[model samples]
Target: MLSLQLIRDKKEFVAERLSIKNFDAANLLNEITALDKTRRATQSELDELLSKANQLTKSIGQLYKAGARDKAEAAKSRSAELKEQTKVLSAKLSETVELLNKKLVELPNIPHESVPAGHSDADNETVYEEGEMPTLPEDALPHWELATKYQIIDFDLGSKVTGAGFPFYRGQGARLQRALINFFLDEAIDAGYLEYQPPLLINEDSGFGTGQLPDKEGQMYFANEDNLYLIPTAEVPITNIYRNVILKETDFPIKNVAYSNCFRREAGSYGKDVRGLNRLHQFDKVEIVQIEHPDNSYATLETMKEYVANLLRKLELPFRILRLCGGDLSFTSALTFDFETYSGAQKRWLEVSSVSNFESYQANRMKLRFKDKNGKMQLAHTLNGSALALPRIVASLLENNQTPEGIKIPKALQRYTGFDLIK
Candidate 1:
């Protein structure tokens, strides 16, 4: 949610920036402005009425002391009328404010000036590429086929127990999943992040605090009976820990990380793109979230991007980072960079992480503020990234590291896996 003051003062600027994301906010801004005007006018009227009623009460007391009964009675009557008017005005003001807020939340965050104008992922700019794509044997199999050959992941068994998009990791596959989780979590903690195990279920307020409610509501798995949502990412619960919190300027950068099983509906998804671990209804991810002072947030964003890239480097995967174009940006993010690892057998890049800076967008919604040096309250900036989502990372690791002997584990992950190869 943007501050009402920002919209009021920079309506044109706001609308123009929103255009980068392909959002036509001219009409929405106009409606919000109109509603705001009405709300302010109604509030002024209510305040004036209350002031008048207060004066009338004082005058009525003086009149009664002077034995002016008729004047006192008339003053009381006027005060009652003013009270009635205030009630109507107050209600109107409340309603107008409510409507204005609805319109405000509908507007997506303004993209940073550096964001490129584009319509889809294809238009994203590749800012960095690292390592080397592997040269695999012609008969090398995709992760799914390899999993079956090794009896590591049983998709059919998972489907029998639940449904599609749910696969059971068995034997080495399950151990690999555990190893990755520990590896990612340890990496985050060593990088100054406080580890947290957050709840998998969140209330609507938590969802909205992270800008997931109205925008991505359909993508979330909702428990209708409990009115809670299954978290789509640990970012929601981890970042929301600071919701409605006020911190001193000294708490400039608050880093936290969580590992969780994320659930997403992935509606309308199909074809080879959704095959195997490319997409999942439930997936494991270690999310790193930061609440930073607005002044240092962008710099913090860069550090975060590099941090994720380093993880890929350590895993010895061929990776590239793409600066997301306006059209591909998330609703709450001012700027985002997506990291993809080359999957050898698939002959394609798989998105393993997205590091994003929300600036003050999520902060405004969450009312997460800080008292700066000047003793003024200001919205803080929020950022989060997938240190790495396990599914695709695992997929790439298996496919790229395949050998005649077995799938060789990267050196960095060997200690965790306790073996050099998965056969």
Candidate 2:
């Protein structure tokens, strides 16, 4: 959420910047301003009425002491009228404030100045690319076909047990999944992140704290009875750990990580894009989150981007990093860079991670703040990235490393998998 003060002081400036995200903020700002005015006016009137009531009560006491019973009764009646007026004003004030907040939350974060104006992923700027796309024989199979040939993943069984978009990994495929989780977690630990095992289900406040609720409600699985949500990423629960927390300046670089089973309602998704491991209802991912001082958060974002890039390098996957265009950016991210790995068999790039600097967008919402050297409290910056999401990474690995003999595991993951190749 944006600071209400910012909208009041720089409504025009905020509106101008939000245009990069293709958001029209003018009308909403006007409504919020009018509501705020009404709220303040009502509060002021209530305060005045309360003050008058207090003064009248004091005068009423003095009037009774002086034996002026009539004056005391008149003052008492006036005080009763003031009380009723205050009750009505207080209710109006509460209603106005509630409506104002709803409008404020509806506004998406402003795009970073460097963010390019565009409508879709096609317009995203590719900042870097690495590794070599594998050469495959004419008969090379997609990961789904390869899975069947090797008896690794069972899509039909998953459908029978649950529904589409859920797949059961068996034998070597299951081992590969476990190995990747451990590998990603270990890598994150070595890089100075504190690892956590967070709950797969999160409360509505946790969802809203990380900017997931209301905006992406349709994309998330909800346990309506409990009013809790299945996490779409470990980032949701992990970043929320610091919600409503206050820290000292020395806590500038707070690093944390988690590995979790993510669940998403991929509604309206279909076609080849959702084929195989391309998209799923349930997936495993390792997420890294950092809370940093505003001054250093952008630099921290670059460090995080490279951290994910290094993971792709270690996995020997051909990948590229694209700076997300405004329209393609998430509601919570000020800036984002998506890491896409090449799927050799599918002959396309699949997004495997998104490294983002949310700046104070999430911090403001979470009330995750730190006291600076001047002893003033300020909203800290929040950043998070998928070190790697398994489905697509597994997809790229199996498809790109296919041989006539078997699928070769990357050397970095060999120790964890306990096997070099999946036959």
Candidate 3:
């Protein structure tokens, strides 16, 4: 949620920036301003009426003490009328506030000034590219084919047990998945992030706190009976840990990491791209979240981006980083850098991680604040990224590292996997 005060002070500026996100803010902003004005006016009237009522009560007491019963009765009657008026004004104020909040939540976070103006991913700017594209033999198979050849991942078996997009990882595939999770978690801990094992199920407020409620409603799996949502990412649960919290200046750089089984209802998704380990209903991801002082948030973003890049580098995979154009950026992020790894068989870059600086967007919604050196409480900046999502990373690893002998595991992950190759 945006700060109403910021909107009031910079309506035009805010509206203009929102345009970069492809949001039409003119009508919404106008309605919010009108509603806010009515709410404030109603509140002011209620305050004045209450003040008058207090004065009338004082006069009534004085008159009654002096034995002027008639004057006291008249003041009492006026005070009763003021009470009724306040009741009506209070209802109006509540209605206006509700309407104002509805419109406010509809507005997405404004794009940062550095964000490129574009319509889609095609227009995203390539900020960095590293490693080298692996040279594979023409006979090299896609990850799915390789999985079947090695009897690693069984999609048909999974469908029989559950449904599509719920493939069963067998033997080495399952072990490799576990290995990746542990490796990512260990990397995060080494980077000074406190690891958390947050509940996989969250309430509605927790969903809304991370800006995943109304915006991505259809994309989440809800347990209707309990009204709890299966987390779409560890980011949702881990970041909400600080919801409604106020921190001191000394807690400037709060970092946390979690590995979770993310569930998503990819409602309209279809086609070849969702093949193999590309997309799934449930997947494992290691998420890194940070709450930083506003002054240091961007620096923190750089550190995070480097951390993710280093992970890919250690895996010896070819990768590139894209500075997401406004239209391609997530709703809660002001600026985002997406890391994509090349899948040799697919001949395309697969997004393995997205590091973003929400710049108080999520913090504002979560009510996560900090007291700065000047003694003023302000929204802290919140950021999160996939230290790496396993499925796609596995897909790239299999495709890019494929050899005539078998699928070779990267040296960095060999110790965790217990074996060097899935032959």
Candidate 4:
């Protein structure tokens, strides 16, 4: 969605930035630029022909009025020739524009200056840690095993009824899930995020508005019968509410929070990491989205990090924050921070949230612009984060708070759960 003019002006800079993501943007930029030039040239030529045709028509009308029927007829033939030329040029312009747009969709967002260069999660840097990693009892087992003994989560039933990675919560496990969702939503509201109940399915425009189409299409469940796709995240529907909208400067920073059950295909994923509540085809999450002035977006990123960190603190779980490397970053995010909680029984850290600043990348695609103080329209910055994801958070809480008597509920959610312990 980058303006070709912007690409023309900052080609080298953008190329260098994308290099961090191992993306060579130079060739694509050149191709886009050439296509733009070709489209523009075709348009200009077509406009000239139309202008000539209009003039000829006017002359023909005057000739007809003057009883010069032969002259009028000659001009009509010339106009027909011009019309055919316009048609050909119009088709070429359309074809070139389409190709250029396809290339634009393939390009990832330019990395921010501070982003570290690397590929994959292995390159991500640990930027912060909170609380001590707790030692588990010698007999501690992973959350999946504990759920079996406690008769809380019924994975086999979920598989039989639906599919893998969709576990049915039973007894206190269901209560805990509901409690965490309520707690997270309440926290988000306290932070000034207006709650939104967005739809769980979206049309094609909604998907493209959030950059989910043209690339991640296979990662979503397509309901071809209705021409809709099941939402992969709340951000898709919630943020797309502003698509094609023009706002006054004061309308930002627009903040919204929503909870949704996300559906993902996870087409090629499997194995150990997909175990238990790790990777799932369906999961619950509370999401926060913000629209801000471009100048303040990076600053807002820090505030978001603190907000999610506070959430983990309220739950009394050990967590750490990692700055995603270029390779590990999402296609549209310029920068990202992921939070992971230590699962004592599992003897590992489980990712619970990821906060990202998309800068103007998404805004451009959405056509979400705001008038600056001077009344000039500009792209707004967009950011979103998972305040908390259910499965892993449930995993971490169940494993970390386990005791022989029962599972201890975090003090913050005790009232919501209606009990301090689940025996």
lDDT of each: 0.93, 0.93, 0.92, 0.91
TM agreement with the true structure for every prediction: 0.95, 0.95, 0.96, 0.97
**Against the true structure, what is every candidate's RMSD?**
2.1, 2.2, 1.9, 1.5
Model 2, 1-423: lDDT tens per residue? 888888999999999988888889999999988988888888898898888888999999999999999999998898898889988888888899899888989888888888999989998999999999899987889999999999999999999999998999999999999999999999999999999999999999999999988778999999999988999999999999999999999987899999999999998999989999999999999999999999999999999999999999999999999999988988888999999999999999999999999999889889999999999999999999999899999999999999988999999999999999999
lDDT tens readout by residue for model 3, 1-423: 788998999999999999888888999999999989988989898899888888898999999999999988988888899989988888888888888888888889988899998889999999999998889888889999999999999989988998888899999999999999999999999999999998999999989999998778899999999999999999998999999999998986899999999999999999998998899998999999999998899999999999999999899999999999988988888999999999999999999999999998889889999998899999999999999999999999999989988889999999999999899
The candidate 3 region of ten consecutive residues with least summed lDDT is 86-95
Off by over 4 Å in 4: 58-72
Best by TM-score: 4
Range of the 10 consecutive residues with the lowest summed lDDT in candidate 1: 85-94
lDDT of 4 by residue, 1-423 (tens): 665667878888888888998888888888888887888888898888889989998999999999999999998999999889888888888898899899988889987887898889889999999987777788998899988988999899999999998899998999999999999999999999999999999999999999999789999999999999999999999999999999888887789999999999999999987899988999999999999999999999999999999999999999999999899888999999999999998788889999999998999999999999998999999999999899999999889988989889989999899999978
Instruction: Evaluate model 3: give its lDDT.
Output: 0.92
TM-score, predicted candidate 3 vs. hidden true structure: 0.96
- lDDT: worst 10-residue window of model 2: 207-216
Q: Which of the two, 1 or 4, has more lDDT?
A: 1
Q: Which stretches of candidate 3 lie over 4 Å from their true place?
A: 54-76
Candidate 3's displacement at residue 285, Å, is: 0.3
